[model samples]
Target: MSQERRNFDKEFKLMTVELSKSRESIQELAKELGIRAELIYRWRPEYLEKPEGSFTGHGKPRHTPEEAEIARLKKQLRDVEMERDILKKGHQHLLQGRREIYRFIACQSSRFPVDKMCEVLKVSRSGYYSSLKGTVSKRAKENQELLSLIKQEHKKSRQRYGSPRISQALRANQVQVSRPRVARLMKQAQIKARMVKRFRVSTDSK
Candidate 1:
């Protein structure tokens, strides 16, 4: 195997071991690996899925008739595992070839007309153009800043600001926005206004 494959295997194994607890996120992992998170996402050249079986109990002897049957079962299991390993290696080879093809197409596209890449890669022209769009537009970023300000106003009022109240607050701050649009964005963001729950109200007393 190449050094790249070796690195991929090590990284994959490390990720798999902590998959259940991978709250650290791939963005964090990319920072550690000194690459973009998108690169990290595209790193699984061979197998993107979790691999199976372990190399434990290789020399341990079977203890009873049941254990002996277990040993036999283990032997069959190893044979099946060997077959799977062969398949994985084949898939890895195919993935490497595909990566090479994509890179060649990208480089060629940079030089020549992109119609060639569209024909070769079999992707739509509109779809390709759409992919070039930046993550967050300036207007969207400005709207987000306004949202932060709106949240601050809502916070000051102890989150009692529903769409109407938030609209009023925004207008008061010279925002000049509509309540319905604010409602839509807030709903899309899942930022519901605070209300006195029975649990909280019942528990509170003088």
Candidate 2:
């Protein structure tokens, strides 16, 4: 069976072309919008050279200069609104920590430009890129290894051992770790010890 062709209006095509300008790749945008990348590539030039007359089919009226100006203003307004939203949402992370702010930027990278996020968040672009590169410190590497051992000990105990017991087990194996550190790592990993309920019998006297 032959499928019918789909048609998009001028506004949607123009919006897509504008989005393509901001995105890293038109192919990614097309996949997200469920349209062919070729369509966006084809529309980009026409939209750039003569946006007012680009998508007008037969018998359709061409846009006036005033209308084109209004469309341009609307696009600018949309961009401003998007940046405003990114700032609003990322404000809390700014108060939290630099790493948190970097994480927020990374989470929103696909939606907003990284440079814009860094500017809005008052973070250095080099710091953000450095975070991506993950220059792990010696302490971080040690903690990761400790966390792996914690997980193994946690599982070996069948979730019956808390941080105290885990700490003792590690110490027995010549691992110099404190109970408090074990507890903190366990909490971070969400590896809580399962509690067993006590059994009690009730007796009735007549």
Candidate 3:
């Protein structure tokens, strides 16, 4: 005995097409819907091109010439997007580069893909993972030290010292660092100088 194929209604097809507009991947939606991924892809353009006229019955799509062109362009756009995603994953492979740069890129991996950074930075995905597991870079370590000193000095002065004064103070202790560098670190650490207000005297005579 052979089981017959299940047929979905027009509304179901239209709803499936709508769901594909989300960030969810087509494979994920197909798995959730218990249907093949290709079916969703196939139905999307047809339904999008002619929402009311599509899936009226049988596999026929009623589309005008303009609608047909629009559907073709949409398909082309999807193809281009796919290509761009692929390129982004493997941009320029640079082998002997700074680890700090990779770390910065890795920090943004939640917004951007790690594979993209790995490709662009010329680091292997495995190398990128290993770098993440490793200790902080020397420059970052120094920045932390400077930031701590900056905080201490900032508080000692009642937060009245901006980068220029802070640089002189650091030099007094033989720190020998640049004011601009101190300023950049302070910015990153969210350290702001406290603004002092001048005292004003008011007198009233009657």
Candidate 4:
């Protein structure tokens, strides 16, 4: 009778070689694994010659260090470009909406391009540069001047001026502004006028 040939996979061959390394004799391990001892001896030299790719299954190439580094850098570049494009939308879908376009641009400019942000947000690049140089907008400058006047008026009135009085004083000085605006500014500045309490005296019979 003729004996049929047996085919062993890479994993089986590797395990057989590792088991042969033990104190157990090759014949003993081969007998236990039901594989011929001569076949195990032949697989051992092949594994030792190239251990890195020895046990890899068929049709799959081992990834070299250079290829892995290139893949990682490609992924990083793709992510950065994606974020840059997302921040360059001219629509009002950005954070804080179109009302605070400059504010949103300022926040996102740290990561993306500031020129792209300004162009997308429909703001002049020069204005953004001026803002970076510590130049305040017209409204902000006006508010600062109004705040100084409010502080002075509040002090002159002995800290007794509320929003209504402050508004009256501002109008009296020909500085036209709404009462609610004054109140809002005062609230933002955390400025509160001292409230005058009425004196109460009780007359008791002696």
Q: Could you give candidate 2's per-residue lDDT for residues 1-206 as a string of tens digits? A: 99787788888888898899899988899999888999988888877777667888831446789998999999999879988999789988988768899999999999899998998888999989988999775777898999999999989999999999999999999999999999988988899999989999999998
Tens-place lDDT digits, model 1, residues 1-206: 65452233444544643542464687776667555566444433322342332211331222558868988999999766654544443333335543343444455564545664554445556655544563454666777877787778778889877889999988988998888878877876777788976654455576
Over 1-206, each residue of candidate 4 has an lDDT whose tens digit, in order, gives 99897666777777788877873688888888897889877778767877767656541335579978998999999866755575555345554534366666676677767776666556788887776687777898898899999999989999899999999999999999999999989998998989788999999999
Better-scoring candidate (TM-score), 1 or 2: 2
lDDT-sorted candidate list, best first = 2, 3, 4, 1
Q: Which ten residues in a row have the lowest lDDT in candidate 3?
A: 89-98
- The residue pairs found clashing in candidate 1 are none
| C-alpha local distance difference test of each model | 0.59, 0.89, 0.79, 0.77
**lDDT pick, better of 1 and 2:** 2
Clashing pairs in 4: none
Q: Write out the backbone clash pairs for model 2.
A: none
Off by over 4 Å in 1: 1-135, 197-206
* TM-score list, all predictions: 0.33, 0.44, 0.45, 0.46
User: Model 4, which residues run further than 4 Å from truth?
Assistant: 1-107, 119-124, 203-206
Which one wins on lDDT? 2
Best by TM-score: 4
Q: Candidate 3 on 1-206: residue-level lDDT in tens?
A: 99778788888888888889993689999999999899998999887777778987665777779989999999999766754654464343233245655655665677666765555455678766766788566787898899999999999999999999999999999998999999999987889999999999999998
